[model samples]
Target chain A: DVKVTQSSRYLVKRTGEKVFLECVQDMDHENMFWYRQDPGLGLRLIYFSYDVKMKEKGDIPEGYSVSREKKERFSLILESASTNQTSMYLCASRRAVETQYFGPGTRLLVL
Target chain B: DQQVKQNSPSLSVQEGRISILNCDYTNSMFDYFLWYKKYPAEGPTFLISISSIKDKNEDGRFTVFLNKSAKHLSLHIVPSQPGDSAVYFCAASALMGAQKLVFGQGTRLTINP
Candidate 1:
């Protein structure tokens, strides 16, 4: 079975602090994605990478950035944490044009 | 505007009954549709999918129906169990090579015994 693991399941950070959320997939998939899910608004894509060192901004990429240094790991970085950024963050991996497998989400809270 | 829409916010059904969740899309270019189920504190899981070429696809207790003319699709779970209660999201992808799925707002389903 394919497994996608996030570094933290729950996190709390202070305002103005830098935050890092890590995701790793054992499937060796070529595509990785980061999305933030909010109530009523649903899931909005933040960033996606098709290959190592390659990234693309999604619809809502402001205040967020991503790093894909290796084939199996992808990281989402919050330059400066704020209260507005608190939400559930999800990481997913997929092969070209194939179904995406998601990891257990990380719930982030900024105080 | 919203490309994919799930108008219903929530639905409640009795256990052992059928639960039908609906989804509609305005983008005519969408060729592939999929449904995902998510539990609280967990990521969404792929449930079933259908291509434009077929009207229906079934897997065990879950079945997906697609209507190209109406640009609508539905997920049917027969004999719905308590475990089947979750939030259902509908998504569509236009191109085959790069599956950039546009998802709906999602519908929360509750099963009552």
Candidate 2:
């Protein structure tokens, strides 16, 4: 089974604090993505990496960044957390043009 | 502008009845479409997908129909069960877009007993 695992299922952070969410995939997929789900907004991509050490900004990437140091893992960073950044973060990995597999998701609450 | 849109914010259907959810896209470059089901506090799961070349694709009780001319698609669930209650999102991707998927606003589906 293709499995994607996130570092935390839920997180709470104070305003202006730095936050990092990690995701790991066991399927050796070459593409990984980070998305935030908001009410009435569905899932909007924050960032995506097609290869190690390579990253591209998505539709809603202003407040987020991503890193892919290794093939199996991707990380999303919020330089300074704000209440507007509170959301359900999802990580997805796909191989070539195949369907994406998602992690359980991390619900972050920025206070 | 929203490239992908799910007109209905929510839908309610009784058990054993067919549930239909609709999606529309404005980007003509999108040639691939997909449907995902998400439960509260959980990541969206892949439900079904249909390529622009084909009009229909079915998996078990879930069937997806695509209309390329209209830039629209629909998902039909037969004999909807309580477990099928979830938010349904439609996504589209173009060959040039690589792996990035543009998603719809999503429709909340409720299955009543």
Candidate 3:
């Protein structure tokens, strides 16, 4: 079975602070993605990496950045955490197919 | 523009009854569609999928129906159980190799005994 693990299940950060959410996949999938889910807004893509050191901006990439230094790990960075940034963040990995395996997700609270 | 849309925000069904969830897409380019189920604190799980070439795909108790002309799809669950209660998301991909998915707002399902 494929396993995707997130660094934290829940997190709290003060405004203007820097925050990092990490995700690792054992499947060695080539594509990884970060998405923020909000009520009525759905799961909006923040960033995605197709390969090591390769990144692309999704529909809502503002206030978010991602890093993929290795094939198994992907990190999402919040440059300056704000209250509006609080959301349920999800990480997913796939192998060049429409099927994606997702991590448990991190519930972020920016106060 | 929202490419994928789930018009109903929530649905309630009695146990042992059938549950039908609908999804519509505005992008005709999408060739792959998927259904995902998510719990409160967990990420969405891949439930089932259907290709544009086929009209129906079934997996045990879950069945997915696609209408190419209407650009719509529906998921049907027979004898719905309480365990099936969750948020269901509909997603679409233009190409299988791209691995980029556009998702809908999702519909919450509740089952009563």
Q: RMSD in angstroms, all models?
A: 1.0, 0.8, 0.9
Global lDDT of each model?
A: 0.93, 0.94, 0.95
Worst 10 residues of 2 chain B by lDDT: B93-102
Candidate with top DockQ is: 3
Show how many residue pairs clash in every candidate, following the order shown.
0, 0, 0
The TM-score obtained by model 3 is 0.98
For candidate 1, write residues B1-113 as lDDT tens digits: 89999999999999999999999999998998889999999999999889899999999999999999999999999989999999999988876545667889899999999
User: Across residues A3-75, which tens digit of lDDT does each residue of candidate 3 receive?
Assistant: 9999999999999999999999999799999999999888999999999999999999999999999999999
* Candidate 2: pairs in clash: none
TM-score for every candidate vs. truth? 0.97, 0.98, 0.98
Against the true two-chain complex, what DockQ does each candidate achieve?
Answer: 0.79, 0.83, 0.85
Q: Per-residue lDDT tens digits of candidate 3, residues B1-113?
A: 99999999999999999999999999989999999999999999999999998999999999999999999999999989999999999999987455789999999999999
What TM-score did chain B of candidate 2 earn? 0.97
For residue A18, what is the lDDT in candidate 1? 98
Ranking by lDDT: 3, 2, 1
The candidate maximizing lDDT is 3
